[model samples]
Target: MSFNGNESSAISLAVATEMTSDYRTNNPNETKAHFFGKNKLMDILNQNGCVGIRAYYGIDADGNKQLVFVGADADEKDLYSGVILDMSAPCPSNCDNTSPLNG
Candidate 1:
């Protein structure tokens, strides 16, 4: 689901209710997330300390083809944060990274 500027007021109220603060009051130019499709493969990777996924168009500082991230575990400190997004059409069935682990 998505909302435009027209629903800004309603979105503010809902965000305040759940997230405790709406971006309108503090920063009028606060960016909103564009999409929220569930990524099932995020589970297996997270057990290794990965943090999240951000699917925006742009480039890394090194100028690599940097879409579909798999990162977020910090340096030297071993933590299993988890993966957040895998932007494939469909991960293979044979892959052990299945759902229900975090469902």
Candidate 2:
């Protein structure tokens, strides 16, 4: 299917909890989530020809997991030379402990 830049990715709370729970059960000691401000997300989306955003799994120098964001065109090509956003606040260090997704 071709990407028209719009995708519905919302999941029910129960599904989200289960997915996060599964990850925690297996990893035990990993970041549960990352926080990116709306401004940063909008900046990526505002890039020329940016129809969507793509995230890549990464590892920082400290061996902690990280996510790198970049703009993706409707053709599903990453705009590597365009704006990139990273350095997000990670869970454990910056998490909402009460959230089911973090539990």
Residue-level lDDT tens digits of model 2 in 2-64: 568777688999999999999999999888899999999999999989988889999999998
- For model 2, the superposed segments whose C-alpha errors exceed 4 Å read none
For each candidate in turn, the TM-score is: 0.25, 0.93
lDDT of 2: 0.90
- Point to the candidate with the largest lDDT: 2
Q: Give the Cα error of residue 88 in candidate 2, in Å.
A: 0.8
Show model 1 residue runs off by greater than 4 Å: 1-21, 34-36, 40-103
How much lDDT does candidate 1 score?
Answer: 0.36
What is candidate 1's lDDT per residue for 1-103, written digit by digit as tens?
Answer: 3222132234554444445234324543332222224445445334554433334354446553224433334342323244434333322222233322211
